[model samples]
Target: MEKCSGTTKATSKKRNASSTEASLPDCKKLKSKDGGKTSSNKVQNKEKTKMEKVSSKKKHKFLGSTEVSQSSKHASKKKIQDGWLEVTKNDKGQLLFKDFPQFQPNMSPKEVLQAGSFGGTYFRPIYSSVTKQHCEDEWKELPEDWLKGLNVPTQVASSTYRDRVNTYKVKCGGSLEMWESSGWIVTQDPYGWFQWYCRFYQGRRTKDDERQIGRWAKCAGVKGRWRNNLITKVVRSGCGFDNPTVSPVVRQTLQHWGYRLTKEDYKEGAKRVKPK
Candidate 1:
């Protein structure tokens, strides 16, 4: 089973907008020729120009780097942005294909993390500096905000997979060993679907995207057996959507699969069931 995952000191010396005009000889000359009135006007003009420049720089910082469109040229380059690194080419220098159409997942990697999928034990054996560094690099590539309320793996004991961290507060999936023996583990995404989803969301399109996407589609898509059957069973019971007792196991299962059972889904299923 796939377990889900500053200051600038320069202003001190500078007083006010007048300081800008004070440095300009033209303004001094204008003041000498036109008296205090023209000096005021020039100062206003200089201040406006200064404000504009500052505003432009702020916008540039806010926008950051432009995302290069995925193309043949960019295939060999590695683009690092936010907290993650993107390598389009392998060590062999051959382009890994990522031509799948954009698939907008219902939940983002951050949302899943905050929601507490994977029982906090997903990232295990992180005690060593080498392993810790590997985990740090992965988490760093994501938005810094997504990790605010999370449990950072500190020790092998506490960080060991705890079902309490999951949204359902229960273990819902098989162990990594089971997944590997079942042949569900892909070498590219050793953690399974959730890992693939996270990497895919990060824009690291590899030769494995299509296969991974296909696997997700089969498991969680609308016609998915796991989801549709559970919805049918829950709705027929006439239990309210908010009812925690309604298929908690299946709900946890879906969450592990990177999908959540919304009230709308429950209501729709209720509509289909004949009242018992």
Candidate 2:
């Protein structure tokens, strides 16, 4: 009976050990499965974050492209109109020509006049012309030695003489103030009169005249005559007063020269010109 009881105790211990060993594998498997699930979740979150960043970058690029397109369109429209020139003064109170693509910095007033001449414009002297009578008397009386010292041509010297005599007869005083206020003084044309004829009358005729005709002319023949007269006036006006085109190259050059055309200006120009 004692041996039988000991055998029964041993059997019970073996069964309990076997049950614990089987349950240990299940506990380990549960731990491994929980770790795998945690790792998978982390990978998925990282992928989602990457996708969001990519999407944000694409949105920004699209917005940038859109803004550039709109700006270019505005510039194109503004560049086609007359009287769109923007003039401003510099720190020295000297007129720094704005909206003039042909003008550049460091150019002397004379040089500017010379260059602008090609566009049917020339710079006129601030002073008024002397009369022929005064030029003969006052200029001829100057001492021969003094005239030689002046080193100017006889014709110019004579003109100066006449100018002094007629100065009183001139309506406006020869001064910068008068020139600015009246807008009468101008520069010489560089390309000569024939070039002016081609540009103002020949080239700009149909397009510009058609538009002007709509506004000013009452009939076809009248409009044609008016257009011809208008071209003649433009050719005579010369540079600084001439209507000029603003090209893309000119716009970039102006920007490089520290002139920033604002978006608002572009928009306003676009509204005014309505370029095709």
Please tell me which predicted candidate would have the highest lDDT against the true structure.
Answer: 1
Clash pairs, model 1 backbone: 83-140, 83-141, 84-141, 121-161
- lDDT per residue as tens, model 1, 1-276: 133211232343455556776777664547655445576676789999999897666445423433333333233123323214332544422224344433323556666777877777555533222122223233444456767866567311135667777777777788766777777765545556776666555555456666676765566555566667677777677676656577776777766666665676556645655655
**Model 1 local distance difference test score:** 0.57
Question: Top model by TM-score, which number?
Answer: 1
Provide the TM-score for each candidate, comma-separated. 0.57, 0.14
What lDDT is obtained when candidate 2 is compared to the true structure? 0.31
Backbone clashes, each candidate: 4, 13
- Stretches of candidate 1 off by over 4 Å are 1-104, 126-140, 154-159, 267-276
Worst 10 residues of 1 by lDDT: 1-10
